[model samples]
Target chain A: MFMAGNVINIFKKELRTYFTTPIAYIVIAIFLVLTGWFFFSTFFLFGQTELRSFFTLLPIIFSFVIPAVTMRLFSEEFNIGSYEILVTLPVSLNEIVLGKFLAGTVFVAMMLVPTLSYAICVGFLGQLDWGPVVGGYLGALLLGAAFTAVGLFASSLTKNQIIAFIIGMIVCFTLTMVDKVLFFLPESMLGFFQFLGADYHFQNTAKGILDSRDIIYFLSATFIALYMASLRIQEKQ
Target chain B: MIEISDLTRYYGDLRALDHISLSIKRGEILGLLGPNGAGKTTLLRILTGYLAPTSGAVTAMGFSIDEKPLEIKKFIGYLPEEAPLYKDMLVYDYLNYVAAVRGITRERKTRRIRELTDICGLSEIMHRSIHELSKGYKQRVGLAHAMMSDPEILILDEPTSGLDPNQIVEIRDIIKVIGKEKTVILSTHILSEVEATCDRVVIINKGRIVADGSTAELKQSSELEYALNITLKGAEGQDVKTLLSPVEGIKEVRELGATNGELAFRLVCDTAKDIRDEVYGKIKQRDWILLEFTQEYKSLEKIFRELTKES
Candidate 1:
């Protein structure tokens, strides 16, 4: 069907808008700076040569940076009254949402590219195990996909970009922080709360244990959030 | 061809369009005339498949809007009143994107874009960002985008709302040129625009069609008469009124004033009658000096007011 064409067209336009603006550069700059700090504090000061510290801090970094890259995906269109034009096109709602999601995912992928330098530096410094490094990259991709989906859902809920950013940050932070907070909860409720946390699955995948359940969990969250974004768009119309 | 029957839309408790029904013939330029909040935008949105009607059905080119929305959307190009556009994109890029989404291939996209740019008088601003354009140019860009796919039916909601006088004339001319090949339905409060560009007029009020006919037929149906102002030197008010009252189709008469011993009287006559000859003969026989006489035709404004003022 021609839905593929619509998705590709929308993806190209959205991606171009993101890169031409200053938001993409700002996001990538901040991500690199934070990762550089983590690298220096762990490797140069503590005299460690492993990437475990770097992979450990990625979910926290992505919680903020992913939303920064995706907060304007739909909210800016609504603010400028361009959503009406987008929805009236012959394309279905699924194609539009998927196109925007893919654009946000590509932006996240670009942000992750510079961090490869950190991985390379760590690899050369020590006799590294490439298997766990590969698993860390996969985990980062899954986490970024999940965060971008949540950010897009938040973007669809409001026309104010600041509010969208704040909401996305809050949602992503909750998903990431719930695991540690569950330690203080009742024993019976810890399992339920840990099931809602992204860090649990991300930690498992970071150690080169590619659990099929963790993959399914991340994918299901991405699908449900994007589905909600499409529904929100319909409500807006 | 477009056919709508019992089409109605409600936003919660308020009825935006109330049982509206109409049909548009092929190659017709129909004007939807109404005041503010007259449901013009709602009706246009429903017809363009942007919004679903709460009740009833609309069939465009024999495709039902509810059952075959994608098919209906393929044939229609809609420009909302706000002219929704991406301000950050250049005109060429944005239109090419629209063309692609509308299924225009890359092989013919450039030629179609150039043709639309020239048709809408947007060739000069094709390379500029949309944010840098003025309101008139932005409206033209919206029109050009709508014309990108060469749709069979074009729905424009107040396409010439914010332009100056000269720009309005230019845009109206372009629309006139476009209407030769495609069906257009434009909504506006400017009645003269309806008279100038529309082959048929659909006057709406309170979500209902008050009157639907040609411009001349609507003017005739409003019972609007022509007024003749006459100034004579030797005639009194009673004499002029009695002479004009006895004429065949004079409806009423009123005296304006007497200036410098000359009498001025206004005669209201059915527009169907040409009483200038009768008045000339009567004044000639009376030996009155015929100083000034002018006939004023009924404008579309009066017809609009008369049609919308009723329930």
Candidate 2:
């Protein structure tokens, strides 16, 4: 059983640590600037009242931004030899993995909070449907959650943060592109790759459909990735 | 209290800890003395629940380490060789966070922090970021972090390493104070550290317990005295070597370098014997001016060398 008290304590410590340092600030700043630039650059050019351009760019921009947020989560602990302190504590491996995962996801979601203004501004320009707008933010969170787990898992594989970030980018990019890469493969493997493809379901949810299947896909992916990360910690013991 | 039986750990095929067992009592400061790569750190890690042994049964304070690691961890404070401090955190904040993880209540967290600050001599720098502190101060903050939960067993691994001699003594005094209340397991390769602080010593070599006893007991057990240094004024190194060859218990003699014009000879003796009296009587009869004749005590270093070299 994963104790809520231990997980919360670990989460609080990680969140407090993020605030005390410049890492969260730098990451959030870069994410906002890049996403905001891409959103506004295409906002008026698309000229329709939809945030389609923004949500499309969200997943692509997040592939890089989420890695920056999660690279230090485990790599720093291992690099500085503080992983021993964490493991020797009374906390379970699940608590550590979840705490760090939630912290990174919440940080990315915090970065996404400012983009809500983009949705509101489009309302002033024209009649914007709230369904797709809300759907876009939900899509961002779901996709961020899934990518955060992959990045978190990558951080556990090495002690160097830069290598973790590179590995995170590669994994996230692969998950986001499994569908497109399947385009070149033989037609026989289409259903399997589409099921494995992150964008297939992500695009469906971004279109204002909150299908439980898509939601389940993201949740199960997050669970599996976090479980793998926890296994890495257990292996260290 | 802790009892370990048939504890063995293997890193892949290489055995890091052989079949060994020991017991620890409350309020006793035990020093784990061993050469580098002699499984000192591996044993401490097992005791602290950070590393599981490949085969063993370690029960601490009525709990088995394998089945109830969390229960064991609640009672133990472990400081690894690197000290495991978060360099980005302020000393006070790091301690507070660790307290939370240890499940200490909010009402007592502040008081515990204050108490540790005083014990670790961190009152002046509690507000300072860990990265800004010197290595000595970082070590102190690490000490405070380990003691945060008010644990019963405090395990410090090479706590005095990477410090100046003055800092070493400062940390030693703190450990001495901690040992007064809690059982302490201090591991190091420094022999004098055990002599200065520990009540019991366990010397491990080649992944096995080579010796275990008090410091005085270890010295007493080393009755296999080997060498004595002697200096002569009138005799050349070769002449002195020839003069001492036929003495009982004398096995071999070699020049121990020159000191001005006086010839120095290091005479190696057979086990369970003393050749000092024979050499002295012969010198007195010949009336040869003996400048210096002293046999160094068989210190822990010699015992460590002899035991480890044999294995």
Candidate 3:
């Protein structure tokens, strides 16, 4: 219980840094612009009151933007040498990692908040499905958290923010594209590879199916990335 | 109390600390003195549980560093070299966050911060961003941060390395006052820093302890060795050296310089006996007029040089 409070303390501090710096605004603006352009440009073509197209493009957009949001988390601390001060404090490494992870997830949720206006606008134009809309938002959160964890792991690998951002993008991009590259794989590996693709599991939730397997996949991905990040930090220590 | 036994640490193949053993008493101001790259920082990091030792173990306040690092950290406040704080946060916010993490209850947090603010002289710049503050102010903020939990043990690595003289004095004063109650261990290569603030000094060289004692005790190790300078008028360099060289306890007498009718001779004496009177007696018996007579006490500076001097 006390450990949870320690995580919250770190979380608040990390979140404060996001709001104080220009990184949060720049990343949020780019996310809104890219998602708005991709979602609206085709909204009229389909002439549907559903947000299927917006949700489809979210995993790809987050692949780029979420890395940008999470890139500074550990890279900046290591670059500026504040990690020494942080680790010496009375908090454990697990608390610090979890706190930073939550901060990134919260920022992603804030970026998604403004897009709710699109759902309301589509509802007014025609009959809209609230079930998938809710599911898409939920899936976007889980996907954002998993990608944020990946970005955090990348940030832990180096002291350079640009390198962290690029590494995070590559890992997230690969996870997004893994299912699309199934033709090269043998038939027996198709099931395994498909299950590994983050997009496949994300789409399951985005379709309002809410399968236990999909939720488990994102949670475990986050856990594995965070665990690896902790191991890397321990190695550095 | 803190006890470290046979502590050794290595970075790859490079040994940073070698077979170190130390026991620090409660409420003692101990100074870890060494030249650069002598493993002072490495030892402090291990004690604070920031780094694991390659061998041996440390126990502080009944908590082992390996098993209860969090508990050890709970009562020890550390300020790393240069106090690499978050540059974007305000001083107040950073201190508040530290206080919360230290588990200071919310009700007592404000009062504790106010106390440190007064102690560290940070009342005026509490709201300023950390990066915008000057280096001295940043160090003071770091001091305030370290004292947030009112810890029983305080570890600071080169706390005055980059500060101005006035700031150094101010920080030393703060450390001295805190030393009255807390077990303060600070590391520095500066000899006078140990002289001014530390009750005990440990000199390390090349990853091993060369000397350890109180400031006066370290000076006393070489107390038998001292030098005396004699400046005389109407005297020749060779005559003055030959005359003073025969005095008992005088090891060597060398002519410093001769300008006009004045001559100076330095006598290197290696005995505890006061040979100044004997030298003066010899000078009075001569026709030479004595101009100056002074003895140079063995300072910690000289002892430090001798101990840490490379072979």
Candidate 4:
């Protein structure tokens, strides 16, 4: 069915579109500047060399950043009516969803790769923990993938990109806050509810623990969200 | 090549397409004529597999739309009403993207793109961004996008809409050329477009098809009447319309007279009744000299207006 070819075509087009606009560059530049400033400020102040603080700040930063990256995945096409053109093409819904998901995740990775110099700088100053650095990046990449899936689903719900971004933020924030917010739930239900939180698994991976359970959680979350997004597209057709 | 049976579509609670059925052979350029909200787009969306009918069946190239949308989509090309395009992409890149999605191999993609640029007259502005192009060129690019796969069926919704007269003619010429090798179904409210390009027409109003035939057949079969143009000699000073306005079956009389002692009058006659003989008798009785009397041809416009206005 040429499914792989369809995904590649869609990915190429999506990636090309990202580079064609100034927004991608602006987003990437802001990401590097902020991450660099925050990392160096903490490093110089504490007189220590570690990326732990930077890793801790990343989840909070990406709560807004990842949604911005993925907000237009489906929303812009729907707004401009180009989704009509896409659906009319011979490609299946799975191909479109997967292609767009990867495109957004790749853009986030492109932004993340430049920040590796921050790790190098830490290594130059003092003894650095390579384990946590690798683990933090893996966690960041996994979280970016999950956030992209959530953002893709939110974008499908509306043609307005701003609304899509807001929806993505709300959904992702809820997933992160689920573990922290135990006020309404009974004490007995806290552990089970904490397990459902997106941040709960990422904490272990961000600490370089490399837990299979955490990896499985991110993969399954991404799969489920993308599956939901595909369902929306199918119902539209 | 296509068969639609008892097709009905509902948009929420409102029925947008109501029990429509038709068959189309390969290589026929069919025109869909309808007013706004007449379900022309809806019907086309169904045919292209962009939409699903509420309760009916459509089979194109032996594949049902509901059962095998991707297979049928592989055979058909559809251009939506606005010709929605990525305005930022260069025209060449956009077409290439479409070609890639259509699974056109690299070797053939290059040759196919060259062929399309030539066919669509897009060579001059191939490197320009889509936003920089004029509306006419945008439509040409959209046409190329639809044709990139060399599809067997093309469903264009308002293919010639929102263009100047010259651009309309250009697009019409393109459609005429493409019609030779492909089965084209274009929808428009402009009867002249249908007259100029379509081999067959289906006029739909309120989601129901009212007329289906070739241009000449629809014009001839339509109950729309024609006008009788009269030129009178030696009756320049007289009010010819006043004299002939009272004739039966003549709904309205319009006069076009010159100061050189010649009068010309046109009469809108009822198709159900013959009024020419009565008008001649009245002219003779009134001693109004008649030089020429002729009936105009029944135009497609007349047929469309009459058919749409009737039910």
Ranking by TM-score: 3, 1, 4, 2
For each candidate, report its DockQ versus the true two-chain complex. 0.68, 0.67, 0.85, 0.79
Off by over 4 Å in 4: B235-259, B265-294
Q: Which TM-score values does chain B get in all models?
A: 0.93, 0.81, 0.92, 0.84
**How displaced is residue B41 in candidate 4, in Å?**
0.7
lDDT of 4 by residue, A1-237 (tens): 438888988998898899999879988988888888887777788886778878877876787888888899899999888888899999888899999998999998999999998889779889998998899899999998999999999999899999999999988888887888877899999988888888888888888899898999999999999989999988986
Q: Model 4: how far is A161 from its true place, Å?
A: 0.3
Each predicted model: what fraction of the native A–B Cα contacts (within 8 Å) does it retain?
0.64, 0.88, 0.88, 0.90
For model 1, what TM-score is found for chain B? 0.93
What is the per-residue lDDT of model 4 for residues B157-274, given as tens digits with 9 covering 90 to 100? 9988888898898889988888998999999999889989999999998889899999878876877667899888777434566777777788888786664666777788887777
Q: Which candidate achieves the best DockQ against the true structure?
A: 3
Shift in Å, residue A136, candidate 3: 0.8
Query: Tens-digit lDDT track for model 1 on A143-233?
Result: 8999999999999999999999999999998899999888689999988889889988898888888999889989998998999998988
Q: In each prediction, how many residue pairs overlap at the backbone (N, C-alpha, C within less than 3 A)? A: 0, 0, 0, 0
If you assessed candidate 2 against the hidden native complex, which CAPRI class would it receive? Answer: medium
Looking at model 1, residue B187 earns an lDDT score of 97
At residue A97, candidate 2 shows an lDDT of 93
The lDDT of model 4 is: 0.88
Better candidate number, 1 or 2, judged by TM-score? 1
Measured over all alpha carbons after superposition, the RMSD of each candidate to the real structure, in angstroms, is 2.1, 3.9, 1.9, 3.5
